[model samples]
Target: MKETFVILARHGATEWNRISRYQGHLDAPLSEEGLEQSRALAGALAALPIKAVYTSPLSRARICAEMVAAQHGLAVTSLPGLIEICHGEWEGMLLSEVEVRYADLIRQWRTYPYTVRMPKGESLVEVEERSWAALEFMAAAHPGEISLAVTHDTPIRTILRRILNLDQAVFWQIKLDNTGINVLGCRQGRWRVIALNDTCHLGGWLKAGEQMAL
Candidate 1:
């Protein structure tokens, strides 16, 4: 069987991201520094033979997918299932604010994520289910080829946890940086992670102060 390579990337930084706010399903445009990060990511993947680019319907992820796909003369295909985990009531709130209002729940989320479902939001299990469906569809559609998927932190983390065969309670252990690249290979029905959260392409901007804590 031919091997398939999937490049998973989180969208670039946003104003909310800089302030440590929960974007969830909310939309936030990329900041000036974010535009640079997208460009750098585009350049980094320019040499690859990316057959398709998938993105969340949200602008933050769509923009980054566009930047990278444009380099290969490909159009980005929006996948709603790839959207960020809905934070619902916690949307737009800073981490500190969430800590104050939902302290116990927040602690549960940190310590036992699978047990703490966000108020009015989807759970990590939901994210994992939908995200895996989307990814499996993409992988099947583009066998033996390279493809890109631009998404958000939680969705990416959920997918990573599933791919690694880990429990959702350990979800926080995976850290994905903005515009970070993760490479996964699938061959003969087996999946292997080749790289995780690679930011070497954005060394210049990261050094210049576009660092993101999440």
Candidate 2:
């Protein structure tokens, strides 16, 4: 089989993101800064031979996907499987709030993410299964070509965990910045991570002397 490359990118900043809130499956719109980031992302990826664009159905991801697709003159494809992990009851809560209320579960989620299921939500295992399937489908549909997927942080992290053969225990260790780009290459029926959490494109948009904490 021919090698196929897929670029997985996290959506830009949202209001929830700035407040450190868990967005989960909630459909939050991108903030003003997020729009700028999305525009910058489109410009950065404009030079690539991107043939297709796939994104989570959620507006945040869709918005970014549209911008990128516009640059390549391609239509955006929304995939439900690429949506962010459902936080269940914790969806709209601030991270600090979840830390205080569901301290134990949060610890386990931070430690053994693969083992714990969100209350009324989903397990990391479930997330990996669905998102990977979506990604695989994308890769299979576009052999010897490049495609881009705009999704959330958790899905990107989980997908990377699988590609890099990393233990699920360190899931949270992988930090994904808003508009971060990750590259995956598939050859011989196997996928390898070519790049991870690359945010170099955001350099011009970032404030001078300000650092990204993602």
Candidate 3:
């Protein structure tokens, strides 16, 4: 059977990302550095035989999706199911601030994320369900072809966790950098991960130490 290749990528960085703030459903634009990273990500995938491009409706993911789609002369199709997990009241707050304000929840989030839900937001189980359904739909729609989907950190991690059949507690262990690329192959609804968080495209930018915890 022919496999459908899906390139799952995390959107480029934002000021909130650099500051360790929760972005959730906020529509933050990419920083200058983020724009450069998106460009590099696009350049790296330019020669691939990509048939379509998809992205979260959020602007951050849209920026990267548009760049990569432009390279292939394709229009980006926004998928709400691929959006980031809503951090609800914690959307724009810093991690440190959240830690102080919601001490118990914050501690639970790091230690037992699967059991903790962000104040008014979502749970890991919720993200996994929607994101995995979205991925399944994408794979079914593009059989035997290659496609790309740009999304946020939580969606990537949750989807990868589900794909790899890993325990929910291991959620925080996945390290997906800004503009990180992941590849998966699917056939008849069976998925296999080919790569995870490949950031070699960013070159020297990886040394900038811009990555921070969510």
Best by lDDT: 3
lDDT of 3 by residue, 1-214 (tens): 8999889999988888898988889898999988999999999999999998999999999998999999999999999989998888998889888888988988888878999888789988898899988888888888899989999888889888887998888878878888989999987777889988888888743554644444
Candidate 1 per-residue lDDT over residues 1-214, each given as its tens digit: 8899889999988988888888888888999978989999999999999999999999999999999999999999999989998887888888899989998988888889887678899888898889988888889999999999999888788877877899766777776888999998999878888999898998833553432223
Q: How many clashes show up in model 2?
A: 0
Say which candidate scores most in TM-score: 3
Off by over 4 Å in 2: 204-214
Kindly indicate the candidate among 1 and 2 with the higher TM-score.
1
* Displacement of the residue 3 alpha carbon in candidate 2, Å: 1.5
Q: Sort every candidate by lDDT, greatest first.
A: 3, 1, 2
Q: Give me candidate 3's TM-score against the actual structure.
A: 0.96
Q: Which lDDT values do the candidates have, in the order given?
A: 0.87, 0.87, 0.88
TM-score of each: 0.94, 0.93, 0.96
- Tens-digit per-residue lDDT, 55-134, candidate 2: 99999999999999999899999898999988898988888888889999988876787888778998888889999999
